[model samples]
Target: MRACFSLDTKTEAIPLVPLTPDTLASWLEAHPPRVRAWVEANGFKGKPNSLCTLPDEHGRIQGVLVGLDTEAPVWSVAGAARKLCPGTYRLDTDQDVAWLTQACIGWGLGAYRFDRYKSAEKPAPVLQLPEAVDADEVLQVVDATALVRDLVNTPAQDMMPEHLAEAARMLADAHGAVFSTVEGEALLSENFPCIHAVGRASSHAPRKVELNWGEDHHPRITLVGKGVCFDSGGLDIKPSNGMRQMKKDMGGAAHVLGLAKMIMAARLPVRLRVLIGAVENAISGDAFRPGDVLTSRKGLSIEIENTDAEGRLVLCDLLTEACEGEHKPDLLVDYATLTGAARVAVGTEIAATFTEDAPLYGELEEAATRLGDPVWRLPLHKPYRSSLESSVADIANCSSAPYGGAISAALFLQEFVDPQVPWVHFDVMAFNNRGRPGRPKGGEAMGLRAMFEVIRARFGG
Candidate 1:
C-alpha cells in the first residue's frame, strides 16, 4: 500500500475494527451472536494488539477486530495492519478524530517497505482513509517518513554528498522552492572551512545545500542538518562493528529533508530555509587529523579532539550560517546523529532534544507524546560546557570526560548557534535495530512528526 491519501481516492474496502479493554464489552453487545461466539471461541478479550477474524455463516471474513492499547495506539494499529491478510480495508471504528488519525497514520507506516534493492517486494495490505481523517495530513507525515527511510537505508556508495544534494534538489523542485549548493573547493572559498576540512579526504568532496521556500513576510524558520554521508572515523577510527552502520551517519540530513517536505506540503505560513552540510568522513593521507584546529564560518576556532565526533564539525558551520547569515531565522532547529551518549540516555527508540529554550522544548515534547512519537529534552547543561574548553582554540569538538557525553556534545554545538535565536537540536539514532509492527529495523524518522506538529500549530497556512 502506498503511503498517500486524497479525499477523492475512496475505496470499497473491508472493515478493520478496533477495540479497547474499556469498550470491548459494549462493542461485543452490538455485534451479532455468531460474531460474538466466534470472538469468544477465539479468546479475543481486547488484549493489547490481539486480533480475531470474525466469519459469516458461509465461513468468509465478515470483519476483523483488533485490540488497542490506548496509551500507545500506534502499536495497536500497526499490529492490525501488519497481521491482517492482504486486502483493501478501511477502519470500522467509532473512536474520536485524534484516535482515528493515529490509526490511519499507523496503518500507512506499517505498510511501508524498503525494497529498493529487491526485484519485487511482498504485497502489503491496503487501507482506505478512515472517516473524519484528513488524507492530506496523513499523507504528509507518511511520505516524509518514507523519504527518510529510503535515504538512510541506502548504502554510502549510492548516497554520497552529491547524491544527497540531488535528493534535496528534487525535493525542493517538487515543492516549488529554490535549491543551491556549494561544493568541493567552493566550500573553502565560501568560508565554510570546517565543513571543507572534514570532507576533504574523500574523492566525493563535501558540499552544503540550501533550500528556500514560502513568502518573505511569514515567520522565518531555519533548519540545519549534519550530512556526514559516511563516517570512517578519520584517524580516530572506530572498531569493526562500530564502523558498520556508519552509512546511516547522514540520518540527520535525511531527517531535515523529510521535515522540510512536510513543511512545504502542509503549506505552513512560514518562510522555511533548510541548510545541510553533506560530507564523507573518510580516512586517507589528507584526512583531518585529531588535535587539528579548524575555523567555522562563524570564525570560532575549534580543536578536533576526536575525528569520530565529526557530525558537529559539519554542523557548526551550517548552524553558524543558518543563525547569523543572511535570511536569519526566527526559530532555528538542527538534527544530527551526533552522539552515542544520547542513545545511551534515551535508548535507540526515543530521540533526545537539546535546547536552551525550555518552553519550546516543552511544546515539542507535549506534541510528541500526543502523537506516540517519543522524544526527550536533555540539558544544554552550562556546567558541562567547561569540559569542551580548549587552550589553543575557542572550543574542542569533543570532551575527554567519560560521562555526560551527550550534554557536552550539545554544549559544543551551542557555541555556533545565536543564543538570541530560538534554537533546538535533535540527537537521534536514525537506524532502528529491532523490527516492530510498524517500525522496521532500518532508518527511522525520530521526532520528525512532533517537530512538524509544533511548527504547524505555530504557523498555520
Candidate 2:
C-alpha cells in the first residue's frame, strides 16, 4: 500500500468536510457556536483549495472545512494533502462516486515525494480509503505513475541507456512479459543503425528494449518511446541553459512504460509490444555530425541538418520496426520529448499530439476529455513535408525553418511510417517547470492515462 493512503476503513481520523461557496454559510449555521465562531474568526471562504479547521472548546480539531469549486478537476483536493499536517483524514461529503475516486487518486499523487536523493523532514498526510471507489484499481494507476516519475527523476548517471534496459527487464519479469535488448555493436547487427548512431558517442552504450505480452490471437498494439537518456545536442551543442534539464530527455520512455503497466495490469485484451530506444546525445570525437547522412533501419537515407534533432532518429528506427517489419499493430503510438516547438505552441502544461489518421486522433481526444487528462491535437500538415526534404538524402532530420517545427518534426517521422498503419505521435515536455496540485516541479508523465483509456475503449479490458 502507498504511504499516502490509510486503507484500513476503521482507522480513527479527522472528518474532512467539503463546502462550496454557496453552501458555506448554510453549513456553518448547521454547526454549533464554536464551529461557527472559528469559521468567522478565520474569515474562511469556500474558495478552491482553501481550508479552515474548526476547533472544539478543548482547542482540538473538531473537523476540517475544505473549499471546492463546483466544477473542480480530479486534482481539486490534491493540494490539501500536501498542506495538511501528518494524520489520517476521512472525507465527509455527498459528492458522487467519480468525485470520490478522483479525490482518492489525487491524494496519492499529491502525497508523492522523491526521497531517493534526500529524505523528507516529515511523512505526508494520509487519506483513509473511501468505500465508494475501487481501491485496488485506483492504486494500480498511482503505482504506474510513480514508476514513470521515479525513472524520469533519476539523474543520467543512474538512468543511462543500460540502466533503463534493466528497469524494463525488471518490469517484464514481474508481468510475465518477454524482454530482450540489443546494445552497442549489437544495435548495428540488429539493424537499428540510427539508435546506435545517436548513442555511440556516450561511454554508456545505447540500447533498444522490447517487451512483449499477451497472446498472439489478440488485437495487436505497439508502443514506442524515444529514450534519449541525456541530450547534449551532440556536435551542434545546445547552450548551457538549454542543456540544464536534459536528463528528462527520456520522459517519453517513462510515459510508455507507465502506459504499458496500466494496460497489462488491467489485463487489456491486446497483444502489447513496448519498444524503447535508449541513447545519449553526447559530444565526442566519433559523434555523428551535421550534414552527415545515416541510413535508417527502413533503408531511408536521413540527412542530419542538426545533431540537436536526434530524438526523431532514435524513434524513426523503432517506429519502422514496429509498423513495418513486424508486429504491425492495429494501433502504433510513439511518445517523445521530441520538439521544444511543441511547448512553444501549446505551452508546457498541455501535451501536443500529431496524427494523420483523423479517426484515431478523435478517439484520443475523447479519452482525454473523459478522463480529465489533457491533450491538444496538432495537424500533420502535408504541405510542411516540403520543409523536411533534403536534396542530398531522401529527407533531412529537420530544416532550418523558424516556423511550425512541431508539425515538421511529426512529418519527418511520418515519412518512415506505413500510411496503412494508424499512427499517433506525442511530442511532450514530460517535466513540470512549476509545481501545481498533483504535478511537482520535476520529471512527469503527460498523456499515458488518456492513452490507456483509448486502448481500453478500443480493446476490451
Best by TM-score: 2
Tens-digit lDDT track of model 2 for 144-218: 888988988999999999899998998898899999998899999989999999999999999999999999999
RMSD of each: 1.8, 1.4
The lDDT per prediction is 0.87, 0.88
TM-score of each: 0.96, 0.97
Off by over 4 Å in 2: none
lDDT of 1 by residue, 1-461 (tens): 36323243465666777787778889889878877787889999898778888877787777888888778766667867678777777778767888778878887787778887988855667777765787788888889999999999999999999999999999999999999999999988899998899999999989989999999999999999989999889999999999999899999999999999999999888999999999999988999998899988888889989999999989999888887756678899889999999999999999899987888888998999988889998888899999998999999999998999999999888888877899989999998999886798999999999999999888885
lDDT of 1: 0.87
Query: What overall lDDT, based on C-alpha atoms, would model 2 receive against the true structure?
Result: 0.88
Root-mean-square deviation of candidate 1: 1.8
